[model samples]
Target: MPPGGRQVLGADLGVVDHAACAGEEPELFFHGDPGAIALAKRICGRCPVREACLARSIANDERYGVFGGLTADERQELQGRRAAA
Candidate 1:
């Protein structure tokens, strides 16, 4: 819900417990470099709440950074594919 796909929440916020990216650098998610993106995706690939993260990303119309392992363009293509399907 914050910029760069990074959220700063207290332990009381349950999302903290399940978000594998919670403590990762926000820049890691927002950087435009290909290597950074790959790393971000790898992190998301193992995340327990990947689908939830993607759903939230699409729901919020996130236009930047990596969310649920997909880049914004990748997410857009995924949406297009779903529509076509």
Candidate 2:
């Protein structure tokens, strides 16, 4: 069983489960206010699978919402860094 009550295939194949934000409202991550972004980052900072979440978001080119404590712009910057490396 994967996170968020969903059974993802290859759970035993090194797939990282992401359930830390399952119970959080979607608005918390997508809001434009800095306070909301900070709250979302705080929640993400405590997540065990934060790295995996960010990796996935980056790989998928996520254009909105906060993932792994980073906003879209942050992720874009990270992508740029990765590309530059």
lDDT by residue (tens digit), candidate 2, 24-53: 897999999999999999999987778777
| TM-scores of all predicted structures | 0.81, 0.76
- Could you tell me which residue pairs clash in candidate 1? none
What are the candidates' C-alpha RMSDs? 5.1, 5.0
lDDT by residue (1-85, candidate 1, tens digit) is: 3653444332123454587898799899999999999999999998887877887778778999999899999999999999999
lDDT of model 2, residue 55: 70
Worst 10 residues of 2 by lDDT: 4-13
Q: Candidate 2, which segments miss by more than 4 Å at Cα?
A: 1-18
Model 2 RMSD vs true structure: 5.0
Q: How close is candidate 2 to the true structure, as a TM-score?
A: 0.76
